[model samples]
Target: MRGFLASSIGVTCAAALALPLTLPTASHAAPSPTREAVPGSTQSLALDPLETSPGSTSTRAAGAPQEQGLTRRDVRPFSLVGVVWDDPDAQLHGNVQVRTRTTNTTRWSTWQDVETHNDDAPDLDTPERAAGGLHGATAPLWVGDSDGVEVRVKAEEPEAERAARPATLPKGLRLELVDPGEEPPQGSRAEGADTGVIPALDKKQTEDELIQARGGKSAAAGSRPFIGPRPRIITRKGWGANEKLRERKLGYTKTVKAAFIHHSASGNNYRCSQAPSVIRSIYRYHVKSSGWRDIGYNFLVDKCGNIYEGRAGGVAKPVMGAHTLGFNTNSTGIAVLGTFGSSKPRAAAVKAIARLTAWKLGLYGANPRGSTYLKSGGSNLYRKGKNVRLKVISGHRDGFATECPGRRLYNKLGSARSSSAHLQGR
Candidate 1:
């Protein structure tokens, strides 16, 4: 479904090693409403002149459904139009229309009415209308079967437009049709529920945090090549150490263009220190067991924020790492440790990620500020099904059908960008 909402831009990176990671803290709130809540009480009864008549008591059937209220007609199919802003509370008030072909007769049903308002609540405003033309000031949509219905939504207005009207939304807002029988959109949290903002980490802060968290000092010198001879064929250990390094016998060439982020998709309770061994097992499974050439990522980060050289990064040439899509030829992959959705990442881990990405972007000469770095067609940075805009840093879901980076880690993208911006300033 295509819907627009006023939103801000941000960044996301990958983490694939093992370690305890904590993301920047956020406030929590109740889940937003997917649709409007059902009303509990009926409207005040209007005294009918006929009901007060002497014999009217006999005419009023006690057990029958009330005809005085609205009634549902035959079901029809419809599509969603744009959602429009109605109030200051951020409560979304919008309309949806269904097109139907009943007995080969075509008809249009439009749902336009007001619902409750919420600036940052968890529930979406309920639909005021339905396919049967049943109308109410506010009515909850039936959650059971919406087989022939579609949905659309819009983003908030621009700053300039918002400044002028304060309460009005922009015109010609874009709407995306959500398919029937799908879950509704979620709402933002209420204010003051979470106080911490995800901020960018600078180089010094990153280094300091990593050092403290890992209980290890940084390499005193610049990066150097492995001292041993290049392997003719990568054994399981070789693949774990340098998965992307080509075997001269295999005739593989290095051509990385983009990086893809991913999560281990395992439970988050595992310790980060165990990641190396786990990665080694993964390599064995992929190569020795599955018969692939090497491991997947070019680099991996543990929960303690230590960066491990992987695949292409271990060699001088661009080694093909299974990171991103068509853009992998010019990319460097970095995977963080731990799942994000259920657990948060450590501040140290986020810092290390910023440092690494900053170094890599500078090496590639790619503008972190350019629109090209933002989400584009086929970018895999967010969830697999959603087309979330990507920053220079992206999540595993941004490109492929995998949940590589967990939500806790993915949530720090904005802070990563902020850190990148700070470096550019320096």
Candidate 2:
């Protein structure tokens, strides 16, 4: 029944659904040109020619003008904010940060850095495969629950470095403010409604009935770790994913060998009930704006310990996703929603990651905490085609020099590993 429930969500129509038809129009416009769910109230302000300067600026060149890059001020009530820019050539050389004020408060926050080491584009060096829908971006930052905000991007390369560059600033800047909804949408996706739950024994009983359905293979293979029971996953349809915006045709690679973990980098200010709509907004941002074939992560986990399917292709299949950069091939990406730079990860979210990796990684008979060799497709950490032995369930930062999965979340990987291993009966 778990597998049936998971696959049942994918039984969508042949063509993609139109935007307005599926979207729930609340206070804001559809965040994406495609469908959007009324998960929360969010407003994305585009950077244009402004008459006044942004509230403040830092990390900029000495004596630099305030009009160096994009700026937005006096925004609506929001707890989280993210910056998006258009730089297809990756020529943008600068840092982007947002400062915000809490509701009914006069003080504003210090500018926090957004993660930018995300170059999830497929390596172009290999002639056999070329990247698709590549978009330049920086990870979103969490500013806690807030109301008013200001955003600025200082595009100042070192004076020495600017002398040899064409342009210092990234073009087309936009600030996205996300406010967690006070209540779940009346008709939100049913599957996501069951948040903070461990599936009933019927799910396990279903697993027993379908043992052969998952491919009967022993856990012993070349020193492989024991596999665990498949965890119940909320499907794209269950999360209200509009398939029309993404690639309809299925794409696949071979068997999964490793799993790389990531934080959605969107902030921790969201309610688990809003996860579906948040995911829909991300889907729109990725496909329509970011120019990616689909959402980057193969899977996404909510704070309530709910696991949602991400990317196209079957969840059980080795779907090729534009995640983990150089390690896209032979690996799967699992992203936990919300920022974790300073915030502590929820125990439920950690347990969900453990249950997920235990089953997904175990399919290949690999230990959750063990190391596995994956040839570097391309990464800043290793050269192309280098056979690097990475943790079977590795953090995104481990593969690339990124502050992804945040420092706080990264620190919790040991617990996640041990829990996953335990779930796998290690």
Candidate 3:
């Protein structure tokens, strides 16, 4: 096992040092030509200049410049949309809105806002952070099945002394249209009862699995630890994650000491049955469009309280994730599907958060209601190498200057922490 681990780490190091494997460069100077999403596949399309005027930059006010987006047009069928730019470090001080025409219908939805994720990213100097082709991106917005899209990005004016000047939009802005593709065929008499859902394990079964994961040897006398029952989880295969779309090597941390909660910020327009499709689309957007190693979160929950595995690593392992800027190490990220800025989070979803954290954090002997110190990798909130005290279960905004897991959701973390502790029997 040690040999295998060493070999895996070696591969991760080599891949990190290798060339930057970024998304294909696109020209954002003009309106992009129509593109198509291949059946059973995902696609990324760049937005062309929407301004009839010669420049990609337009003035919203005296000294305040704005960036134009693609003119409305028809394209291949897709179910999700987002915007990405050339530099991962650059911030888009702007507003992004998109409206799409439903497939085979004249009905065009109202323009919807895409949350600009200014700070959620991998730590500054890590291989994943420094990888070539990574881009600054907005939170992906799920748009269901559509063949037409229109987007607009307007820069907000700078604050204080710079109020007269318009904020600069990140360069190389492009539109990403993703088709989550078809759901995978269900398994017959497989691990998930042929329904794609991993059955929940009782307390004894979970302990046994934990023992097996720890080399199958019994613990020392009186050393058995308290643990929560393992909850049912939907597998990546169940969501039809195209393994080929992500990087071949998986990333890991030594241990998980914390869990960060987030909202997909992808809006609550989807049905519970469509949750798998939403996961697949975000997976594609994270890898194919955002140019990351994989989906940024370790686990995702639907509004119906169903848990779906995110990223490719084992669910029980401390898979390194990219969900929170400056604090991805030694922590897991749990994102509930949909925007919760104003919408109240569903009770089931919040309960699922507690249930997941109780079990996963219990495996590492962490008290979800307590606090721990983690060194910042560098963020707007903390400098690199600075150790900061954080709740064992925290919201995405706790570590970064962004509204994630949204307002209503963030407010619920206190109860989630208490419930998680209770589940762990602490």
Q: Which stretches of candidate 3 lie over 4 Å from their true place?
A: 1-43, 48-62, 188-196, 211-223
Tens-place lDDT digits, model 2, residues 163-190? 6643345666667676543433344444
Ordered by lDDT, highest first, the candidates read 3, 2, 1
Model 1 regions lying over 4 Å from their true place = 1-258, 312-317, 325-327, 373-390, 424-426
Question: Which of candidates 2 and 3 reaches a greater TM-score?
Answer: 3
* Local distance difference test values of all predictions, in order: 0.35, 0.64, 0.77
Descending-TM-score candidate ranking: 3, 2, 1
* Candidate 1 lDDT by residue in tens digits, 231-251: 111112221232232221211
Candidate that scores best on TM-score: 3
Q: Where does the lowest 10-residue lDDT sum fall in candidate 1?
A: 1-10
What is the C-alpha RMSD, rounded to one decimal, of candidate 1? 22.4
lDDT against true structure, model 2:
0.64
Worst 10 residues of 3 by lDDT: 11-20
Supply the TM-score for candidate 3: 0.85
Best of the two (1, 2) by lDDT? 2
